[model samples]
Target: MKASATIAVARCGERDVVIDQRCSAPFSVRQCDGRILLASSAAAPVGGDELELTVDVGAGALVSVGSVAASMVWPGVGGESSSMTTTCAVGDAAHLDLSLEPTISLARSRHRTTTLVRLGSDATCRVLEETVLGRRDEVSGRLDLSLRVERDGRPILHHDERFGPDVPGAWSSVSVGAGRHVVSAVLVGIDPGPPEVCVEADRSAAWLPVAADAAVAMAVGPDRPSTMNMLAALHPALVRTAPVSKPRA
Candidate 1:
């Protein structure tokens, strides 16, 4: 199956959120106040599924986006692979909160994902990405993930990761370790606080300052619940309570 989804939000006179434009196929989008929820209406992604998504935040707009449930990538059939690409643009002083559900890669599956974000000078953003290697007692398939972020036309972050079969020594890499689940969060245009690290029974989490206005948090856990707990503990340190106001030109 192939699908595409798009959403654009603009700020009205004062605090109203205007959905300038929206389109979706196979994937459904619902708007509530300033928050948007996405759900898949079509069958779960299989071997050769493809998906595309785009989001735009108009100047001064505040919006949050989330998914209803986790996505599962089943093994490819007939050597077909799956892929997804997403792009986002945040206008000046706009605030975007993207809390995506986890993705599980089943055995023998092959999938690729890419994300690109462009932010205005004063824009603020919070993004989360999580992945689970495989189901109980099963080895994961293959996955290639890439993320890029730009601020005022200049690059701020560029990251790429590959996991699963075919990548030599990938399973034992220090970055991923032997954990079953991994979660990463990025915060932009937010004040940085002191760095903190926490270790629990089945998870390890850390909040690191990337820059004065940027921060990143990551967690690796034996299971989904433990990983989510770690993420919750680190969220307050990375997420800003209020959006930053745009400055006069």
Candidate 2:
């Protein structure tokens, strides 16, 4: 299923905002917590399900995009799989925050997610992500995640994580989920809150709350040697733009 949402800031006055929005088939939204929740449900198949979601926030706007409920990845029907691709755009000094809830993959169901972000040099954006391998019961299978960041059409950073059956206690390990439902957040732009605040969150992961001259990125999951190295080698500019230094716990 393909779905899109666009918000344009006409004016910002006194903590009030004016927005313009549009959506396509299989994508819908509901109001909650002074924000809008976007959602999509698609037909599942064996190879998997594919959901492409896009959002654009015009200049000088503050917007947040998230789901009303935890996203689900069902087992592929007839040998099919499921995946999602999300793209976001943020303009100058504009704040676009996507506070995503947890994503769960059922037994035998394989899933992947790719996020692409584009932002103006002065734009500020904060992204959040959480993927939980199995819920209360029926645990198994691998979940792959891929992320890419770009600015001015140039690739910045990329990450991929895979978790599942072959892994030992795959979903509960410190390198994987740390026995807790994992959650991740990325904040970028000229002014990204205070340094202390970012450090607190990064302590939850590894490197974080860094500066980005133009862009920033991150990825998490059961480690695959190549994937982690590749994410680190994403681009010198990307790593330099955002200083993500980590002190081993």
Candidate 3:
């Protein structure tokens, strides 16, 4: 029962879009101004859920992170198991896009996510992640995931995934989020220019911020496809939500 939240968002957009933020939580955290809205799905809380978050972006402020639902990680029916943690800080010519979506671990869940970024040497960032696996829909059990990413403090990227089935690489096809279900990654900010940014960094779905900076980990299973490219799997608050998704109902 260690719930937590700390947010500091200030860009107040004209084009810099941070929208708005100011939150402190013990429980009861539903946000506005772009989003952060998830109050729990299956609804049951006596003393087994934990959420910790800390976000700060000020120096050239620009932040966009939206999520209010699609956070389902439940699995502790008297055997006890529940957890969550997130951290972020961005300054220096600041611009941050943290839209970490898709997290579902029904059944018997245990989740962990840790991220740290401190770049003052021309600071700029783009961090997007995704994870989905819990039996396409017809619930089962077992889910464990851990992730960490850091820069300037070094720890480029770290990983873990265990959706069960003896969990030893959980069915390795040569690494990371193996046997897939749907796992994604993207990390940017690095453009020292020259030679068309190293030939557009060999064209691995270009998410051009300055030049070409990349970190792409892929997993999809069944012949393991998804070499990630749709403009380097574009993330920057998903290009501002693709122009408001004006499709039909």
Best by TM-score: 1
Overall local distance difference test of candidate 1: 0.77
Assess candidate 3 and give its TM-score to the true structure.
0.32
TM-score of each: 0.88, 0.67, 0.32
Better candidate by lDDT, 1 or 3: 1
The worst-scoring run of ten residues by lDDT in candidate 1 lies at 240-249
Residue 221 lDDT in model 2? 38
User: On a 0 to 100 scale, what is the lDDT of residue 165 in model 2?
Assistant: 71
List model 3 lDDT by residue over 1-249, tens digit each: 666656565544433443344444443445455454434434432226766766776666656554655566666657466666667777676656666546665555555545555544355666565655564643324555566555456555566555655565554443333333454454555442322111122122322332255454433432212423333344433233422211110
Q: Report residue 122 deviation for candidate 3 (angstroms).
A: 8.2
lDDT of 1 by residue, 1-249 (tens): 888888887777665354654556668887643467778876556789898879888898877777888888887668578987889999998888877788888899898888888999799788778889898988888988887778898876777888886787776645577788987777887776878798766578888878789877878888988777777777574433443332111
Indicate which candidate wins on lDDT.
1
TM-score rank order:
1, 2, 3
Global lDDT for candidate 2?
A: 0.55
TM-score (C-alpha) between model 1 and the true structure: 0.88
Query: By the lDDT metric, which is better: model 1 or model 2?
Result: 1
lDDT of 2 by residue, 141-206 (tens): 567777666555665556666777766556443345433244444556544332221112222223
